[model samples]
Target: MKTYTVNELLKGEQLLQQVKVNGWIRTFRSNRFIALNDGSTLNNIQCVVDFEDTPEDTLKKLNTGAAVCIEGTLVESQGKGQKYEVQVERIEVLGTSDPETYPIQPKKHSLEFLREKAHLRVRTNTFSAVMRVRSALSFAIHQYFRDNGFYYVHTPVITGSDAEGAGEMFRVSTLDAKNPPLTEDGKVDFKEDFFGKETNLTVSGQLEAEAYAMALGKVYTFGPTFRAENSNTSRHLAEFWMIEPEVAFLDLMGNMDLAEDFIKSVIRYVLDHCREDLEFLEQRLLQEEKGKPQNERSEMSLIEKLHFVLDNNFKRVSYTEAIEILKRSKPNKKKKFQYIIEEWGADLQSEHERYLVEKHFNAPVILFDYPAKIKAFYMRMNEDGNTVRAMDILFPGIGEIVGGSQREERLDVLKERVAALGIPEEELWWYLDLRKFGTAVHSGFGLGFERLVLFVTGMTNIRDVIPFPRTPQNAEF
Candidate 1:
């Protein structure tokens, strides 16, 4: 007898063959039927028990969440909703879960409640589907990059330089907190720290990837990045994964093309490979939105929204043009926007980005040439001297799905921007060296991997999509 997964046995490939299966019991009904799942698929395989021949002790241990191994002959199910089941001839309990203590139950539980039990949330249908789609999307990301002549690069997780230059970084010093080494001026001395200097978790891999792109021509990094921002919003996460791709000679326009093509390619792969999980999530979203008002609901279903992105070409609009449109739109005129688009330099919020995508363009929109002051120091300065060659790809629900810029390859111009921002040149000397040696017109974008997962899975909260969400003041498990 060969051991088979619930997913394999459910396929009816070896009907009449004796099979051994191991899974956690989902439900044991009437002491004769066991619904078993082994995390192989969302669907469970029915294991019909022989109550007459099975020992009473063995049957008693076959409760929900109990791990069990069943030796049975596969047969076509006479039951409804499923095609095949197992006729159990022998059974052994691997681990017994106490029903009274198990946190997960068969009934519908609140997402909030599930978050508390994040350790075991994957056992639920919604989360199982979500994680499966997440896995597929991960594979799709690497596959797309590999097939497109890009090399995968692993950037350091801890570094001395701040990539975002926002200064909201989690310190990685292995020094005493209360009684640390003091400098001559009485400030905590970082010279005695583990790395002999200050370091923190990386905020983004773009800077490092740029270095690699200079050598490798095309390279990408898929890894975890940290932020110390104290935000409790549904969209904010203290820790998240980012997919950043850097190309040696790609401009802003070419960067936009790559972002669009890359997103569509991975999404199409998920649509092709993870249909069952995606369909399950689609229905889950439909049910979740049923209680909301008609105006608040999505016009297209989850699957429809994904196809809409793939089928349509993203509209390209300049920052100045978008400001003009927003200033003249009904939302701005009627004071419907929470943050009014009063001027060109005002950073666009989620509401403004949503209007451009959902109303103004009625399609995905890529806004470019953001004001230099609002963008980071690395973006290429435009000829006008007011804006940088930066672009943000906005989606229907998520405001900005991708952000990128043509990095400033001109050594003098980049130094000016860095000095203007008061960033010390020494902190980024290695980065400046790339421009000194062999810099070309290069561009890349950072896609928040969780946001993409959120969009694909129709998961509203950023926390629900990640395995262990690190948020403000909450680091449990």
Candidate 2:
């Protein structure tokens, strides 16, 4: 007999049609009713099996988490509560699961406990819903970029240099740890390693995407990225995904427009395609203390918030103006900030970013023209002597979702900035060569994929969204 997907069964119009469905039992109540989810959709089919129809011995052996195939007739329920249910004709146990051995039970399991059994957590209702949403969101991302004439670029995972320049890298090596290869000066010699030099997992694909964008005019990369920052906070992850888009002949405004449109499209797509899953989450999985409330928070949901941010023109202010607003704000009155916001130079922290987006603008805000001394050397220096033409997109819940700018196209100025930043000229010769050959104006942004997922799903912790999350001192499977 041909098998049907659970989602297909739900959408089918043929009631009382004989169908065969296979899945693990989610829950079985009173041996007469069983809820089975195939992982094809968030909605699980409730099968009504009489004790006489299912042999007493067979019924006794069946348990939650056991894989089973059911031959049933789909019927519109005359019962008041549920719309439809399956009337079981015959059942076959493909695999029996011992209730005591199964890690997931019908009882409430904490997120910490769930994380330990990450491999099996997807079988649960909450995780099944989350994974479906995650899959839908990923598809939406590719669709948005592909529809907009952006070429999908696959950048390398193993790289020779750090793209973020943040100095947090997980080294790739084959040398013995106890007695490693050493140079004449008693330093660890990376030349003896597999790559014949220092190599590490890529922190970002932005730099490589820029090269592709220069040639292809528009390109985006979606891939795994690593960071070795020893942070155990809810927001920090050692390994996570990043979506970066680079466009040639695009200025700062164009970059922002693309970012805004890309984000909004993904949100709209996921909301439309994963309505059932999202609704399930909004109703049961989410709560006020444990999860988000079902009631709509804003005039628009998170998906609509993206459209609102994109449809309405964004508020753009220079770093100087933002600092002035901060200085005048009430929080600045009580205690001295660790990074004071002054006129010419000061780094913006999470608090300052939140204040601008949440308090001052009451919407998504873009702050640009940061002091060159603080920003990356690749950012284009503004006409003003002090600041560079970099921009950061700050959202209400998350501080900075995107960081991008028009790149420094002039080789002479770029070289000067590189020198002033104390980076060796030889290390970046290939990057400078692009400027020497044929450099047109190019811009791009590095978006934290987890942050975007958090904002869209209303998930508070970044760790919950990702599977097998890696954090500081936590790499347990």
- Please give the clash total of every predicted structure, in order: 0, 1
State candidate 2's TM-score. 0.93
RMSD of each: 0.8, 2.8
Name the best candidate (by lDDT): 1
Worst 10 residues of 1 by lDDT: 57-66
lDDT of each model, Cα atoms only?
Answer: 0.94, 0.82
Give per-residue CA lDDT, model 1, range 1-477, as digits (tens).
789999899888999999999999989999899999998899999999989999998888888889998998999999897899999998999999998999887889999999999999999989988898899999999999999999999999999999888999999988989899999999989999999999999999999999999999999999999999999999999999999999998999999999999999999999999898889899989998999999899988999999989999999999999999999999899999899888879999999999999887988999999999999999999999999999999999888999999999999999999999899999899999999998799999999999999999999999999988999998999
Candidate 1 Cα misplacement greater than 4 A, ranges:
none
The prediction achieving the highest TM-score against the true structure is 1
Task: Determine which window of 10 residues in candidate 2 has minimal summed lDDT.
Answer: 290-299
Tens digits of per-residue lDDT, candidate 2, 1-477, equal 568877777776657789889998988888888888899987778888988867887897679999999988988876655577889899999999999899999888887788889989888777787777888888998998889999999999998876667889999889999999899999999989998988999998887888899899999999999999989887989999999999999999898888877777787787778877776665542353344354323334454555555566567888889888988877776655555665457688887887787678877888888888888889998887688879998887578888999999999999999888778877778888889989989999988888887776666678888988999888888
